[model samples]
Target: MAISKPAVPPRIPCQQCPLRPRPSFRDFTEDELDFVASFKVAETPAEPGMAIMVEGERNPSLYTVLSGWGFRYKILEDGRRQILNYVLPGDMIGLQGNVMKEMQHSVEALTRMTLCTFERERFPQLFRSQPTLAFDITWIAAREESMLDEHLLSVGRRSAYERAAYLLAFLDARAQAAVASHTELRQLPLTQQHVADTLGLSLVHTNKTLRKLMDQGLVRWLDRGCEIIDAAGLYRAAEWRPPKEGARPFI
Candidate 1:
């Protein structure tokens, strides 16, 4: 938690939040919005590479990402890290921390990020007063689990080409939805090591596989990241078909 910056008033209030009008996000009722506005404790910032939460730490607050990107990972005793999932706008983190004695994974920001913080103790109030919102939160957890299931399958069963293609396509699709209304498509901010850790592949293997993708024009590597050049092509190569989804809930 490197948010040593001074506290400041929230620039974007819940009512005028930029993400609300985007087609990717489910709409909130006036009452629900009001409650959410009150639910927020503060808006906090996390710089790139900052640890938002660490494994085995007890976090006092939960977070809803308001902007930018982050990833969840778990490190083994020997220092090897396995990325669990990518976090984007509207994703709620620290829920597990609230439920368990300590967090099982660590989260690190990939870009300068803003997060809406909520008191962990206030979670019970939401469940008691807002059944609908509680269900929405449950749905988010279920969806994350489903995504992890697919990743487990990929790591265990898929080929190198298939894994690389699927990973890029998946990130592209999710980024498109998460960054709604942005004029340009959001380029993924991922390094080869990031993909390797996520896919359970060696760094060299990840490089060769991504090179194959670049050769075929499916993706292009940038300074410390890569951009999805042809999403449909990558999807076809991976033989992955993600289920279509409409606007989904975000707290």
Candidate 2:
């Protein structure tokens, strides 16, 4: 897995950020936007399967997903990997690196991705000067924690079929919120192996669960992805309802 500095930095002026105007995303004031624009260091690009940040490394920067998909995960001594969560567009990555001296988990790209880098040292200044931005950062962290809690509940207590249904509905809702374009909602970039790791099931078990969902017309497996056929059906099967969320800030 390789990480490279963008040869030609992608100009992502905060004022023109595509996510800022979306109802799912909060708008930034000119002053706040200007601060963020200046705070941004550069664009970093990662190819599919590249490790953006490694476990136990002391990374100097934090990042926001400018585009594409990635995931947070941890590997055990036995090399068993557990995918903690998906990182979609506008999601923050490496916030833990700022609080802890070393990263406790790793982040890897699932698709070709671009990330907006921010020097970790400037985070304190941001908090002191931009209270609203600081609050948004806290909100993002809380949201991540909430999702983790739900994932824990699903893996620990739910039946395999219910777990599979919850995961599909969760990802479908998150992916739909992240993209402005409706066409992107039809498919998610996930494989059976990713599903297995996330759901804490063996690959065989994951496939069986997914096949059942497909048979019920809840979802369909693509060559390298999954398509949600009936999101409501999946939610019903899981007995889950997504919490209402406010416009989220894109840091």
Candidate 3:
């Protein structure tokens, strides 16, 4: 039996999604949209464990996550992989390459990931045509860099419980933004291995850490997703505070 491919959703919804929630079209006149739309194309679907880009490959293009989650990681010479971070909906994966010229780490789908790719060369024209889109894209890249910096702090300075607490707090904020609620949040779709790699913990330690959080009434797991049972407590445990500017800065 031949397997059927999933139908690609029309791009119009991308212009309308609550996540996009900005004046994207205003950045480009109709002429520019029409011109750029011609080059827009559906990408091949990436399976849950597939690598989108290897560490040393030429950066292919800027990727807009149309669906699913992905993460980046760097493997040590001894072959241990330390996951860099997670990319969720409305996130772009290759913006760093815009400056670096090549990928420094591998990016892989953490779920059945769908994306829309814009080539590097076409990006200049696209940005020139849609200044707002360019700004949004730049803002997203800076946000990702800030997140990585925060993750570095968590791994470098936080204890196991603190690390787990920080992950819970972060996900609660992200899910509330992306999926609509923190209390109702569940179904994170991330496995223990993913959590371990992401938190820079051994699998055993991650498991223990999660159980401790559950025991402390700080977080709960249900329906394959985690819910913050005590947001204030979790934040305190993680030593988390919204930055003074209300957002972390890229540096």
Clash number for candidate 3:
1
* Position 15, candidate 2: lDDT: 74
Measure candidate 2: CA RMSD: 3.6
Q: Against the true structure, candidate 1 has what lDDT? A: 0.88
Candidate 2 lDDT, tens digit per residue, 65-85? 989999999999999999999
Which pairs clash in model 3?
187-225
Order of the predicted models by TM-score, top scorer first? 2, 1, 3
Residues 179-246 of candidate 1: C-alpha lDDT, one tens digit per residue: 85366654888889999999999999999999999999888899888877777888898886876665
For candidate 3, lDDT tens digit of each residue in 39-102? 4555556898899888877875767676687888999999787888877765677777877767
TM-scores of the candidates are 0.94, 0.94, 0.79
Model 2 scores a C-alpha lDDT of: 0.89
State which candidate, 2 or 3, has the greater TM-score: 2
Model 3 score (lDDT): 0.70
